[model samples]
Target chain A: MSALRLIARDLRLAWTGGGLWLPILFFLAVAILYPFAVGPDAKLLRATGGAMLWIAALLAALLPIERLIRPDWESGFLDQLAVRGWADEAVAALKIAAHWLSFGPPLLLATLVGAALFDLDGDMAGTLLGGLAIATPALAALSVTIAALTARAGGGAAGLMLLPLAIPVLIFGAGSLGPNSVGAMPLLAAVSLGLTVLAPFAAGAAMRALRD
Target chain B: MEQRQAEPAPDAVVIDRLACLRGGRLVFERLDWRIARGTLGLLTGPNGAGKSTLLRIIAGLLRPAAGSIMVEGRVALADERRALDPLPTLRQGLRFWAAMDAQPATATDRVLESLGLAPLADVPVRMLSTGQTKRAVVARALQSGADIMLLDEPMNGLDKASAALMAAALAAQVRAGTTLVLASHIPIGIDPTTTLDMAI
Candidate 1:
């Protein structure tokens, strides 16, 4: 019940901060623009549908994460939340899950619509959503861990530093629908979950560092 | 003054051979401290005496490099993850962790008319001022049903009036057989019952 309350509190904070809209705009706009920058030809755009959709997702899913944990860390609530008796893994899961609910699903839908507009293959849409379903939690968990690691939140450069770490998700999420089998997508998912569980320990330690 | 037995004497907290090093800087080296039953002990030292670090370790919120803490006749923090016992997690109710700093926690309110916080019963703990926060911390120590309370600087950041309230609350707790190992510089108004100079 308290976990839900905390999650609800996070959602309320996210909503007031327009966390949803900024990413929504960025996701949609970038989805619309990247193909044109690469090439104006519709044929090239059509050919690149799967890649474009996944890339847009990776970009969109990641943009808000830079700001994801700043408030909680700054507020001193992260350590307090840890001490609240919920298992560390459970707390980590709830934070990542809430983050995904607010940011991931909307971006997925936006990407699906973008894919349809671009005449991307139907199976690739399935891949986009499925891969994202597998990967969004991973993205959130990894971001939380990295943010916890850096401790000094709100650094714009930190997000960029963390982006390369998600390349596997970008790779598999974009290519999982390929003619050849994509075995590594699930592997990417596993790594993300592993990070989620382990990140809390680091986050707890980082918080000790922060307290001083 | 002879037969003063209100609440039973709780167990002591034993911290032995505790050492901690952060980034190669030794905070403490083989420090040993023992907090007895029902005594209000103060932890004092200069700026870097590692008072908060020691408190965190005692609270089972952090781990010591080489040492152990036992409380209530049991290993207090055998595993960094475990406490005196996994003090039952707050399932649903009002709680006063640091989060309340921005969330408005009250430390006291009269009966008959309650605010939007029945969950915060047993004595208000949300919407509290600094002294009130300390008082609430003590109230929580009482409510926690824990025999021993580990308070860090129980008097810092509190005004004189709030300090009196806190002192009274501490007195009440100590009188109830609740031991307090507090970290503070300013007198928390309790007759300096006991003091442990961390600088030593």
Candidate 2:
């Protein structure tokens, strides 16, 4: 019951955050504008669409995590949860799951809209969505750790810290669409899968750090 | 004044030798204290005295920089990481943290009333008038069911009525045979069985 209460509180805060629309707008605006800036040749748009979609996807994935964690920290909810018979790992998992639910699927569908706008064909669209589906969990995992680690520093700075670390997700997400190299897409997917599994450790460490 | 006793309780909290560094300052060195369980104890001291520091050290929240402590016959501050994965028993340890110092005003009113908070519990913990927060904390501690209670400034925010309630809770817990150790600037109970004044 206690664990559920903590997670529900986080989900409610995320749902109520007014800025959720801003990221979607930013994603859409960036996706559409980049093509025009680089010259709107259909062929070139097709060529760069995967990369642009992935970049937008990265920002979208990265954006909500800090927001998700900030309210909890500011409210001192995290520390209270820790004291309330909750292992930090369980707490981290709940936050990550909540992050994925709120951001992952919606962001994937948005990517679909962007890909269509960029004129990405059927096969590429499937791969883009597939990669995103696999990658979004990993993104939440990353956010969980970074948010936990930098929670003391406050929210905005934590988001900035995560911006640079998004390189791998960006690489693999876009790489999923570019070419048919046997290992590339799988490796990317595998990394996200791996990160999805591994982030709990980092998140738990962050929880312990905050307690100390 | 004679020390009060609830039941036949443990006779001592033995700190063999204690040490801790808080925020880079060495708060204590080889400090020793032996207080029996179920006995009223007071640690009186002026401001900046290592009173809270001593509580943390005893509670195992802060590791002694050196030496050791055995509370009622167990390593109260044992390093759980190295000692063993499964503790023999955790029932003996009871820790209740404050509302993390939030204000007394409340965003939601229901949580206040449900906890019998009514008008006062509605406020954020920080915004809560001292006595109101005290009542809430004591109410929460009662619900928590921890065997050992470590409270910091339990009476800092209470009125006469609430302070009486605080005294009632402590007496009731002692009646129910719960070990109570609290630190406070203001006195809630008319009589404390054992008062260890840190105000030396």
Which candidate number has the best lDDT?
Answer: 2
Candidate 2's DockQ:
0.10
Q: Give the Å error, residue A102, model 2.
A: 2.5
Candidate 2 lDDT over B1-200, as tens digits, reads 13434445555466666776778887667666666665555666676667766666666545678887775522111111111101111111111121212212231232233334565432334454445544554454554445555566666656666666567667776666555666666665746666656543
What ranges in model 2 sit over 4 Å off? A19-25, A65-76, A155-160, B1-7, B11-14, B34-39, B70-116, B120-134
Write candidate 1's Cα lDDT for B1-200 as tens digits.
34424545433767788988766788897777767687776778876788867877776656788877775521111111111101222211224331322222432221101212233344432334444444433443344445566666666666776566567767876787667777776666776456667783
User: In order, what lDDT does every prediction score?
Assistant: 0.59, 0.62
Work out the TM-score per prediction: 0.72, 0.77
Query: Where does candidate 1 chain A have its weakest 10-residue lDDT segment?
Result: A76-85
Docking class of 1: incorrect
True-structure RMSD, every candidate = 7.3, 8.4
Task: Name the DockQ score for candidate 1.
Answer: 0.11
